[model samples]
Target: MDVCLLYFEDCPNWKVTDRRLVAIAAEHPEVVVRRKRVETMEQAERVGFRGSPTVLVDGADLFASPDSAAGFSCRVYRTADGLEGAPTLEQLRVALGLTQEVTR
Candidate 1:
C-alpha cells in the first residue's frame, strides 16, 4: 500500500500527522509512506492538494472528503473525541487495517 502525505511547510499540524503515519506503518510493513510539500498555489492546483497534512490512502483521501476545496490550508478532522487538526492514532490504525477484530 502506497500512502502519500500532502502538506505545507508552514503548518505545525503536519508534523503530528507524519508521526502518526509512521506509528501506523510500524504495524503494516507493506505500507510505503511518502511526503509531498505543497509549495505554491500552482502546485496545489495542479496536484489537487487540498491542504497541509492531507493523507492519501492509495490516492484517495483517508478522511473521505472529496467535496473540500483544493488549496493550501489547514484541515480539521472529526474524531471520536472532537475536532482535531490530525486523526487519532487509533483512527489511523483502523484506516490501515492493522487492527484485530475484537467483539465488544
Candidate 2:
C-alpha cells in the first residue's frame, strides 16, 4: 500500500500523522509512506488537497468528506477521542485494511 501524507510547512499536526505512518510502516513492511509538501494554494488545488496532513491511500483520500474542500490549511480528524489534529494509530491501521493492534 502506498500512503501519501500531504501537508504544508507551517501546519504543526503533520508531524503527528507522519509519526503514526512511520509506526505503521515499521509493523507492515508492505506499506510505503511518502510525504508531499503542498506549498501553495495552486499546488494544493492541483492535487485536490483537502488540507494539511491529508492522508491518501492508493491515491484516494482515506478520510474524505463531501463537505471538505481543497486548500492549504490544517486538517482536523474525528477520532474516538473526539476531534484531533491527526487520526490515531489504530485508525490508520484500520484504514489500511490491517487488524487493530496496540501501537507502541
Candidate 3:
C-alpha cells in the first residue's frame, strides 16, 4: 500500500505522526510511507492537503472530512481520549487494517 504523509515543516505534530508511521510500516511489509512537504499554499491546495500530518492511504485521506478546507495548517485528530495532535497507535493500526482478529 502506498501511504503518504503530507505535512508542512512548521507543524510539530508531523514528527510524531512520522514516528508512528515508521513503526507501523515496519510491521506491515506491504505498507510504504512517504513524506510530502507542502511548502506553498498553491501546492497545498492542488494536492488536496487538509493540514499538516495528513495521512493519505493510496492517495486518499485516511480520515477524510467534508468540511475541512485544503490548506497548509496544523491538523487535529479526535482520538478516544480527546483532541490530539496525531492519531493514536491503535487508530493507525485500525485505519491501515493491521489489526488482526484474535481467535483463541
> 6-97, model 2: which lDDT tens digit per residue?
99989999999999999999999999999999988888878779988999999989788987889877898888778998988888988898
lDDT for each of the candidates?
0.81, 0.89, 0.87
- Per-residue lDDT for 98 in model 2? 94
Clashing pairs in 1: none
Candidate 2 local lDDT, residue 64: 81
Give candidate 1's whole-model lDDT.
0.81
Q: lDDT, candidate 3, residue 47?
A: 82
lDDT tens digits by residue: candidate 3, 8-86: 9999999999999999989888999999999988998888899988998888887868889898778999887889989
- In model 3, the runs with Cα more than 4 Å from the true position are 100-104
- 98, model 2: CA deviation in Å? 0.7
How do all the candidates rank in terms of lDDT, highest first?
Answer: 2, 3, 1
Q: Which segments of candidate 2 are over 4 A away from where they belong? A: 100-104
Worst 10 residues of 2 by lDDT: 95-104
TM-score against truth, every candidate: 0.86, 0.91, 0.91
Q: What is every candidate's alpha-carbon RMSD to the true fold?
A: 2.5, 2.7, 3.2
